[model samples]
Target: MDEENQQAGPSAAAAGPAGRPAKSELVDNQNFEGQFKFGRLVVILSALAFTLFVSFLDQTSVSTALPAIATDLNAFETISWIGTSFLIANTSFQLINGRLSDIFGRRTCLIICMVLLAVGDLMCGFAKFVVPVTVLAGIAVFLVIPQSPTSQGRMRDKVKMIDYPGMFLSLAGVIFLLIPISGGGTTYDWSSPLVISFLVIGAILIIAFIVVQARFARHPTMPFRLFERNSAKILFAHNFISGVVYYTDLYYLPLYYQVILDKSPLTSGVLILPLILGFSLASAAGGFAIARLGRCLPVIRTGYVLWTAGAGGRIAFGPGTSIATIAGCLVVEGVGLGLSMQPVMIALLSNTRKEDRAVVTGLRNFLRTVGGAVGLGIAAAIINNVLLQHLPAGLPRAAASQLSVLLDTLPVEQRGEVVAVYMRGLHCVFDGRAAGDGA
Candidate 1:
């Protein structure tokens, strides 16, 4: 193994209590942090925060916009793809981007990502069609976000070190798995040969990917050794579940407001502010609390309690539900998410060897994003299947397929039934989310 790979390899056999890495095995990179002056560090953090904000906005800004996009393009059935496609691309390339940053320089990669995002955003603004814009944005952001600086390596060595087979397997696996889930009920029947074929192939490839990581890759993108500690396993599980809940809420809540509540897109966006503000404030507070308490479990547990309550509250949503009640539930859910998100990272870093920090961090992100993609797929399937089964018989199949457009054009007398059916689908989604949180 190369020198970098040796350092990044599995921890020594000797273990601390609970199979955790020994303190002596943990390399402290305090000097790296010390390299930055206080003011410089502040500037760097601010810039990074802004980058994250932009990236998140790019991910979520489409939520409130989906209703409008569906109506405008008359493609309500495919609207979910705008978000799912981006996440698919994002999740597939996430770990590879981290490795790339190590090979090239951070600054070089960051600049390229920013430029791609800017270009994608600009093109999206002008595009008349939906698919093209989504494709462009997905490709642009695939390698655009997340990473840290590291020493530049020789081109030949870096190229050889890239886990090409692992990358291909992971990328193809995600694509195959998601395509069927997203399209099964909406675009094709669940038992269709194409969907079945893709699912079987995807599963096989995923198993192969795991085998390659465990037995073949010299510098595995996700080192199995990190899961040695029980804490690490729990933390990763929390991260994945939270991602599912977070993205599901972000994507579906606006649909609830606009479609069921008869709110405009702008009004729905405005209403979602409570969730955003509550999450942001709680995240900040949680970070400080962790620093002060020097513990993460308490906060994580508290957050889960709140999250369950909030998610449970969502199942009560109805045509008669008040705006205040909706907003309150959202705030509680957001705060729960905020409280748990950061501390999980801190907990993971505390347990990990410093050499493996970067890889683990990337893996954390990869799993969360993968969860988001899968969650969205499952959500879409549930909603679409429900709509297919429950949509009013009087409505044409063509019209039923594009409910957003139908709502816009349907007479006042016919709209209520359609809206009620849509509400049922949303209720199912919320119920599943609640069950997930409680579990």
Candidate 2:
């Protein structure tokens, strides 16, 4: 452990009433006045939501533009890297940013992240490269999110507060784990020594990271006590599933349009509009529902039900599915995501003490990012592996690898065969989520 580990745990004086928090902590509605006025809070959430939308839009837009990008760069095999790399960088520093936000304040973190995002976009525009752009975008999102009011503090030694060892271990663990999962069969064989080494090392580091959190960490990046309640466990699982479904859909739907339907990148993006609108509307509705009901579970349940239904519906799609049908399916999912997403955060706050809000929020977001990254990896692996195994007998490996980009150029029967294989992979992605939902 580093010298920083000595300063990891929160002081006992600040812990207050050991073990789980009391019901008094749950009296959020009664003592809510000191936070923000309902109207002002609404406005703040709206601003923060818009900020999130813009940042996320920047991320999703890359997927829509991917076919064109792969063609232009002649890097179709490495296209998955564009998204995975972003997710890796984004997820790696999540807890660090969460702690930093608690210390420096959300506004300061947002400004820094947004500025970095702008700089990253500018770099992409000039250089026409995606890796650095994704990295910058990842860094930009680290602080733009709204933390609970309790996270703001009067602490002066914020820099010293970071758990450097935990950060490194978690980052290494996630990267090592994700690289092989995402790259196996596509970049390297599953049985390759490189893959086995990464998997083994990643698992060990992850266990070490958990050990640090459980015992060694002074102020653990993710406190074990956060999962003490059944509600917290459920919410974390819910958030993780939502992350998987959300990212998988976001990344793959564009492919469905571009690859199966043979639409242009810009056209695919335009088509994704309905899903976004549904998401925005549903999100707003969730906020209103929670505000009126003074509880988040009902809305969350409704969202999950809708989300499950939407994922199930998407499995019905194929090469001949109508645009209207696909759009409708996306709308269903959008509504579900909107209704369920923010309520989880609200539920976490309702369940935890004010002091732990920042960490809880960080953990929630961290899981979601991890879910998204893992989902993308799984989706990529399925798509690549399936294509490798099932692409038409006559097509060369190189052509089949770039089949998504070159689908339209092939003869009609060849394109059909390729689309059939691609759709199988796409359907598998959705089906897995549907199964997860059912479980």
The per-prediction CA RMSD against the true structure, in angstroms, equals 5.6, 6.4
Q: Compute the lDDT of residue 260 as modeled in candidate 2.
A: 82
Number of clashes in every candidate structure?
0, 4
lDDT of 2 by residue, 1-439 (tens): 6555344333322333543222212111113567888889989778887888777778788888877777787767677677767777777777666666655666787878888878877776666666667777776665566655223223434555667788888888988987787677667888999999999999999999999989887657787888899988988988887788788877888888888887888899989887888888998899998889988889988987887787789889887888898888889888888888878888887787665787788888888888887777777778877887998788645422356676667888887787888888888887998887656
Number of the predicted model whose TM-score against the real structure is largest:
1
- Which tens-of-lDDT digit does each residue in 244-302 have in candidate 1? 87878887887788778878878888888888888888889999898898889898888
Q: How does candidate 2 fare on TM-score?
A: 0.86
Question: lDDT for model 1, on a 0 to 1 scale?
Answer: 0.75
